[model samples]
Target: PQLGGPIWADPIHDIEFVQKVLSAVSTNPSRFGTSKRIEGMLSMMTEELPDVPLYYALDHLCSTVHCNTPAMLQFRSALLHAGYRVSMSHASRNGLKTDAPPGVIWDLLRCWEKANPVKRERLSETSPAFRILSTEPTLQACFDVREDANPQSRKRHLVRFQENPQANWGPKARAKDSGGISSELEDKRKLCQNKRKNQVTDASQLKNFPCKRFRKGTCTHGDKCCYSHESASDEADKME
Candidate 1:
């Protein structure tokens, strides 16, 4: 099916960007880092660009399949509308060499996927295509959405989430900062500490002497003790 609507712009800009990228890589320029100029060019493609990076996998590293597959682009674009990070992989072509290079000939496609969520949402809403390229919610977060917006259960059922939901992927800083203690409990602890620091008690002035050692069951002096084991109850009563 012809998935895209009529093209409005001429192919001139496309040709210009492609030639510029090709020229940049060809000159062996000093600005290129790690002899990986192609990666730099790939990174720059997202600069004010309408494209989403889709990395389809070859089970065999050195396969004959062309890198720029048009069908993959359309399929991925459709999936992008549904809020997904889509990549196609050949299952049967696993006969390649084991000592392959790490990472991409370009930056990892998923990293590029998260680059522009606004453009992605716009692409998603454009054609209303149902051809699913992928279903995985590559980005969503309880942390990303407002707490009232969607519950954690509903988060998984939907693709789109709050803007920049990556913060949900990490440990919650607010919970850690508060040490998971509630404000009431923390206040009670502070109150107890303040009582210990600010209130001085004299055993001689007390009507009922409470023995600290009795609480731990370490008191050897029973009836002869000036502090009474029963005084704990009296102290509790006084406080109440």
Candidate 2:
């Protein structure tokens, strides 16, 4: 429903696809630590999805307890990946400690300060949450464990984030729309291929939009290329 992409194609819905993996994580989250197998499984979603995942839908994906070292670091990394600017400011860092480990309010303030240091510093910072809300307002996961760092206790939290309609395509829609979505995805791939293919011949254009195949002159788009097919001299004259 948001910029994360359509349904299963986004990280906002990852908990749905990987519920089993998440469930396997126990209080000794170290039990299900980042192993080669887990990493490989995680890689599948990103490798298949268009771009790298922007943000993980960790909202409610944390335990009511406390976050352990691994969870804290991972949560911070998730915010960083989601384009949140983090700072090591005394105020922000100190503020972060008082709250659960997963909230990004302080990070949002850091981002705001970077963009408007003078005004931000000048203003009385009452509600950091309010400050965070004023900026780009999209709901993001801020899941954190209560007092326990045990991953097993967070199973329900993970499931909570999965209850979103965006995560569930509904059985009927899944059955009906699967083929259509696949077709659309294939069409997009071909379109990108053609765009890259046509970007050959013109070095400047190619640099800006390199073709995967045409770089080696194997572009099947040929004269049908959407990009300029100008030679070096021709390109120079055109630039002039």
Local accuracy of candidate 2 as per-residue lDDT tens digits, 1-240:
235444453333354556556345432356754443353333333222232323333222221111112344344443455544322111111111212233454343334333334333433456443354346524344433332322321322222112335542443222233444332344545556756664357545544433556556777887667655555676577679
Give the 10-residue window scoring lowest on summed lDDT in candidate 1: 91-100
Worst 10 residues of 2 by lDDT: 89-98
lDDT of 1: 0.36
- Expressed as tens digits, the lDDT of each residue in 1-240 for candidate 1 is 123655444321364665567577647656665334353333333221233222234322112111222232333343343344333211211111111122321122222233322233434433322112122334331112222222222233322112344543533223334468343445545556756564537755442657788778999988766676776566688789
lDDT by candidate, in order shown: 0.36, 0.38
**Estimated TM-score for each candidate:** 0.18, 0.22
For TM-score, the strongest prediction is 2
